[model samples]
Target chain A: DQQVKQNSPSLSVQEGRISILNCDYTNSMFDYFLWYKKYPAEGPTFLISISSIKDKNEDGRFTVFLNKSAKHLSLHIVPSQPGDSAVYFCAASARVVTGANNLFFGTGTRLTVIP
Target chain B: EAGVTQFPSHSVIEKGQTVTLRCDPISGHDNLYWYRRVMGKEIKFLLHFVKESKQDESGMPNNRFLAERTGGTYSTLKVQPAELEDSGVYFCASSPGTSGAGEQYFGPGTRLTVT
Candidate 1:
């Protein structure tokens, strides 16, 4: 079963607008969530993250909101630029063992920004 | 410092062949992880290593797959008699902290094609 899911396969946004990508999880044990951006030929790059303790976390133009009660999270990029276009993946992690954590990733959402 | 790196960016081989994918985490980072994305599926965790030890390997698919971190600096994932279903992109990631809270850095990924 897919514990974490990104229902939207793709999204397009005009430049200078806000781009929101959504994700949901079925596992309640997941306490940490992360967002990663990936270009076609490169590995995923960490974007932002939020702990279950906080409802929101922001860095520069990227912001992540978590609704633990709803088992959902979303990533928002304000003034989205052309360079922001890429495949975005949502991942979650819990303390499965001591001194290490494994990540469970979603299918990913492809975001395209138009000029 | 350099980011995580993977060798043999792309590999194509027939079924029943043996293949080994390697990953070199950033210097001084003791945590290493292996993950893969089969076609039409979400990225899934394979295993995790902490300083040359297997901390969590519950994600490994089966006995056909083997992972090793001999010297604690790099890791290798070998699939003997690879099957067609094994064709996918394999990713490696590393983190510096002991907590599950640390952000993991990813490599470019190795694309394995089983014909």
Candidate 2:
């Protein structure tokens, strides 16, 4: 079963507009969420994250909002640029009983920002 | 100050072959993880290591896969008698802290093709 899901397989937005990507999780035990952006043939880079304790987190042009009651989270990039076009993945993890960590990821959403 | 590094960017072999993928984490980082993405599927976690010991390997698919970390600095994943289903991009990630709350740095994945 897919615990994390990204319903949209692809998205397109105009430059300078806001691009929103959504994700949902079926497991209620997940308390931390993260977003990663990946370019072709490259590894994913961390973009932003939100803890279950907070509803939102922002950094530069990226913002992530979490709704625990709905088990959903969204990543918003304002003033999206062509460079922002890539595959975006949403991930979540629960606290480890030991000292290590494991992440569950969603099927990525391919975002295209038109110039 | 380097990110995670993976060796053998791409490999192609016939079925029943043995393949090993390596990962070098950032210096001083104590957490290591392995993930894989098959065709048209979400990236899935394979395992996690803290220091020199495996902390969680619940995601390992079968007995054909083996993972090890030596000296707590680097790791190697070996797939013996690889099957067609093992074709995918394998990624390695590391974090400095012991908690799932820390941000993970990823390496360029190694793409393996089993014919």
Candidate 3:
């Protein structure tokens, strides 16, 4: 079974609006979460991250909210711009797994910010 | 500083052929990881390396796949007698040794297509 899942395969938003992408996980051992953005033909770039201790974290126009109890997280982008269009992936890591600190990623949500 | 980099942005080969993908992590980063995303699937971890030793490879799909990070510098992943299902984008990521939150920087993926 997939440990992390992005139910939305794609999302569209107009410029200057808010874009929210959601992700869910089945493993409770996950304590740290991250969001990565990717453009076509490029590698994923680190966007933002949140630890289980905090419910929310924001970086400029990007914000990430985490609900550990619900095993869910969401990424919010304010005033979404045309350049914000890309694929966003949610990843989680098990806190107890050492040396093997690999991440489990969601399928990804393609965000399109139309001008 | 240079980001993680992957070689041969794209590769196409027939079934039963062998292919080797390479990754170069950022300088001084002690942790390297290998992950892949098949068509219509989430990115899955393959293995992780702490310097020259493999810390975990449980995610490796089968015996045909092999990974090595010799001398703790660069890494290589080889798939022998590849199958059509092995086609996808392979990603490499790295993190600092003391990163407790597990924020990994990813490299542009290498797309592998098995005909």
Candidate 3 error regions (>4 Å): A96-99
Scored against the true structure, residue A106 in model 3 reaches a CA lDDT of: 96
Provide the overall lDDT of each model, using Cα atoms, as 2-decimal numbers.
Answer: 0.92, 0.93, 0.93
Which residue pairs of candidate 1 clash?
none
**Clash totals for all candidate models:** 0, 0, 0
| Interface RMSD per candidate | 1.3, 1.3, 1.0
lDDT tens string, model 3, B1-115?
9999999899999999999999999999999999999987898999999999998999999999999999999999999989999999999999888886678989999999999
lDDT tens string, model 1, A44-85? 999998888899999999999999999999999998999999
Q: Which tens-of-lDDT digit does each residue in B49-112 have in candidate 1? A: 9989999999999999999999999999999989999999999999985545667899999999
Deviation in angstroms for B61 in model 2?
0.5
Native A-B contacts reproduced, model 3: 0.91
| Candidate 3: tens digits of C-alpha lDDT, residues A1-115 | 9999999999999999999999999988888899999898998898999988899999999999998889999999998999999999999887564435889999999999999
What candidate 1 gets wrong by more than 4 Å, as runs, is A96-100
- Tell me the deviation in Å of residue A20 in model 1: 0.6
Model 2, residue B48: distance off in Å is 0.6
User: What TM-score fits each model?
Assistant: 0.97, 0.97, 0.97
